[model samples]
Target: MSVENVRPVQSNCLLEVCVDSVAGLECAIEGGADRIELCSSLELGGLTPSAGFMQTAAHISPVPVYALNRPRSGDFVYSVLELDLIERDIEQARAAGLDGVVIGVSLPDLRLDIGALTRLKTAAKGLDCTLHRAFDLVPDFDVALEQAITLGFSRILSSGGALSAEQGLAMLRHLCKRSSGRISIMPGGGVGALNVPQFMALDGIKEVHGSCSSPSEAVHAKVTALGFASESSKHTDASKVRALKAALLVPSSD
Candidate 1:
């Protein structure tokens, strides 16, 4: 790592892919992702995965597995019960020997709930805590950034409140410069190999997150003991993972 690249924590210009399935987890590892954010129900933003799944991923993943501690998909505002679930998920991830947990909470008015955030951070204790995309919903991005730093969040994944990281690149750059090494600004939501370098070249970004997905049409077969095999499979994009990794390897002039 270069001196300028020395973020508050160790920084790597690599892919942090979200895996909703065991096969996806393995694919992420095979493609050389720097880290994996394990979650379920990618269709609904993403919720906490089963403890068994968390354990299995941790046991076999070659890279760090950061379990998603979210309880639902709608808004980031959480009830007391939801908060409890988040804490429990964090504990389960720690017990499972995982790397970290990604979580977030904001006021109903779309502002940082410092108290609730502090509670979550405290619960995270020995594990790394990443403030999720909720940061992008904050009423004031700068204040939210400071609050995250004060609350001890190591990093954040955001899209500059825009629909995608590309649209939010300017704000992402501003946030990184304003961060002053206090926190890592990770860009996610619609990131890809083609744009990974753009995000990395922005001031203060050390990591980029996205799912590089492509179409695939491989048939999976099930074999029976009666010397008969049933062929059944759905199209799955198996190339995006590797392609994304390759995109990150393109060295930046900066």
Candidate 2:
């Protein structure tokens, strides 16, 4: 394949898998995920993982792992102390050899908090930075896109303010086009193997994010004996990952 063709084929659909626990991390890596976003308390919409968890995830994950640095989950609005905690987490993640940091901050009015973001970026000096799905909550997607680039974010995880990626594909494509290579517009939320082909069919999308989940039937087991395995753990399945990858190849065939 020509380099340009191969380049897009290889990276046109980056799979970002979110892992709630160590088992989820292993599943994402085994499932052919290109990268991972590690966090705890998905029930609270994902808070920063503990130091021990961060260390273990970085060591075990085969693909690059990015730590979610949110101190709490209620909203993207953050306190100064929470920002400080996030900065410290970023430092720890980098030292632990994690690849990046996933963070978000916004004004009470739901606009990107430019000043807070600038500080967070500065703290993550040596690591890649991704503005998390909180981007979708910003009042103005267009304005947020511009600020993300200007603030030097490497990528953004969003769902176009919708509940799922499919619903947001139109806006996702628009953001990707407007980004103009200045930043990467990554469509996340409610992504799965079933929609990979549809997402690939849309123009300008280069990456996708999701937590492909199946119920953990073995939920009655305790972690002490099973060693961190949850009775209801959600992990990326390798078959699903391969299916999604294959689906992305269809456009090139056409």
lDDT of each: 0.80, 0.79
> Which 10 residues in a row give candidate 2 its minimum summed lDDT?
1-10
- Model 1 per-residue lDDT tens digits across residues 1-254: 22122122123576688888887777676666778899986757778998999999887876788999888879999999989988888899999999899989989999988888889888889898899988999889988998889888899899999999899989999999999989999999888767777887887777888765543343343343343432232211337766776776654479
Q: What is the lDDT of residue 142 in candidate 1?
A: 89
How does candidate 1 fare on TM-score?
A: 0.85
Show the colliding residue pairs in model 1.
Answer: none
TM-scores of the candidates in the order shown: 0.85, 0.86
The number of the candidate with the highest lDDT is 1
lDDT of 1: 0.80
Error of 2 at 113 (Å): 0.6
Encode model 2's per-residue lDDT on 23-123: one tens digit a residue. Answer: 77766666567788899977566889888888887776667789999887688888888888888999889888899999899899999999999999999
> Which 10 successive residues of model 1 have the least lDDT summed?
1-10
